[model samples]
Target: MNNDKKIRRSRNRLIAGVCAGIAEYFKINPWVIRGLFIILLLIPHIQFVTICIYVVLLAILPAPKGSFFENFRAHFGEQGRAASAEHKQRSTSTSNRRIIKDVREHDIH
Candidate 1:
């Protein structure tokens, strides 16, 4: 077993991914951490402390690699890559035409 695990926020987070990061580090389900948070919050005196801790963890934990949009798009497969390639091909072919719309008199020599 490799022991070089780093606790970073997960991409599959419902919120800030603080709980997910902790769960991942401990090798447990993210729901377990969520459940614990909820349970702690249910207690009268602990609610405020729980919220504070969650906020602190959210601020402290590092985000996962790639932007949120990138991660979200990844779930829909590689359609973006294929579309970008097609767009490039189309753009190049059209750009080759080089339409001279207007001949300007002020030519800088």
Candidate 2:
């Protein structure tokens, strides 16, 4: 028998994987759970409440360990780390440029 503990799925997730996790835990199709959520959203009176519940579940669920994206990144060794570093560098450069531009504009006034 499968373990009863529920963990968020990383493979079949559209958002935070709450529905996928629930489907896996209950041995049901993920699509069915998604469809049920859609139906709940269509109800006028319960739509906001349903969205809130979904958000709560998303926040509460713990992601599965070493799941799909993490495994893929691990398989590529240093590539993921390099990409992350590059992204950080780019963001820092952009912020610096913005600060410099603001300073120049202030000096002009």
Candidate 3:
């Protein structure tokens, strides 16, 4: 396993991406890490320590570039772009039709 890869915070984060980053680094499921964290918090007198560690991780780990949703959209490649373009075209066409209708109604008055 390569240890040199910098552990950056994940964009797909509910809280701070600490668990996600650790899961990604270790090739494990993020839920498992999150569960472990919750379990750790439940231990007697460990809640404070667990919170401190989480905060420390948040402070130390660098955040990954771009947001999770952006990355997810990027993965869809051309299909995502095409959908966005088509939506914009439809919006403009609808607006143009509305404007033309309003003008025709005004001219009849």
Candidate 4:
């Protein structure tokens, strides 16, 4: 569990990770934070303020390592990244990539 008080953006962000980071810091589900934000955003008077705060937090919070391009090319999302980081620090000697004889784009179910 996250024990530190410092809040940083989560890599599994839907948008900018502001809500996810806050929820992570507090050890709560990210949806709760997102839901509250949505509720606040629906209010006529608070819409602008809510958006501004979210933008500010988005700008202030730091993104995790691996540049944007690297992450774009990454095979996994936040959960995979975190699990690999904590449990598997290095690639095993036997690790290797499997080559596919055929490749095509189609709908996956």
Candidate 5:
């Protein structure tokens, strides 16, 4: 029921919705942005440089916080949130093994 014009999160995008979000914002076809980038990439002099700059800008520019990552992640499965949480838990536990070991030792008393 969400009537917002935000880009569909289920669709793959180049960079955190930079192309899709803008297209949605302007009510234009997102493919146009993709095509423009492709054309820019085909340019001889500044293709690589332009793409890099666009990527950098996309990463730095905030796009409604979890709006970008979560939306993209949702496409994976119904358990996307749970999977992400479990992955985070595993990573943190591995990284904090020393701290966990110390706490366990103290608790042995």
Candidate 6:
């Protein structure tokens, strides 16, 4: 719930959440992000470079509270505020929290 660091989306991850996280940051679809990444890779040896960049970004980026893309949607003024607030709530909630959902489900068995 820290306003300073943007959390990446853990629920969405095709490739380390790099494309999905960036898409969420920019309020775009993860598919679009993945497409752009693929296009970027098509250019000569950029694939390796892009992979490296993705890896580095993934390691450096923080996971978003719920849907990683929600944070970026906050830039749109009113909607952004609402989305940010919703994300904060989902992130900070005592129950059904994203990170804990896994643990809770595990305990259910």
Candidate 5, 35-65: lDDT as tens digits: 8877888989989897897777576544553
Count of clashes in candidate 3? 0
Per-prediction CA RMSD (Å):
9.8, 7.6, 10.1, 14.4, 10.3, 15.5
Q: Name the weakest run of 10 consecutive residues (lDDT summed) in model 1.
A: 68-77
Candidate 3 worst ten-residue window by lDDT: 98-107
Model 6 / residue 64 / CA error / Å: 4.1
User: Which number leads on lDDT?
Assistant: 3
Residue 52, model 5: lDDT of 90
Ranking by TM-score: 1, 3, 4, 2, 6, 5
CA lDDT of every candidate: 0.82, 0.78, 0.83, 0.80, 0.65, 0.72
Model 2 misses residue 101 by how many Å? 48
What would the per-residue lDDT of candidate 2 be over residues 7-96, giving only the tens digit for each residue?
Answer: 665457898788888898888899999999999999999999999999888767655777765566466758878889998898878555
The C-alpha local distance difference test score for the whole of candidate 5 amounts to 0.65
TM-score of 6: 0.49
Q: Rank the candidates by lDDT, best first.
A: 3, 1, 4, 2, 6, 5
lDDT of 4 by residue, 1-109 (tens): 6665678788768987889988888899999999999999999999999999999998787665575833753645676888878666545434554658878889989
Q: What is the number of backbone collisions in each predicted candidate, taken in the order shown? A: 0, 0, 0, 0, 0, 7
* Residue lDDT tens for model 3, 1-109: 4588878788768898999988888888899999999999999899999999999998887778686644664678678889899989988785566443444334554
Q: Between which residue pairs do clashes occur in model 1? A: none
Candidate 1 Cα lDDT to native = 0.82
User: What is residue 88's positional error in candidate 4, in angstroms?
Assistant: 46
The C-alpha TM-scores of every prediction are 0.58, 0.55, 0.57, 0.57, 0.44, 0.49
> Where is the poorest 10-residue window by lDDT in model 6?
97-106
Q: What is candidate 5's CA lDDT for residue 11?
A: 37
Model 5 clash tally? 0
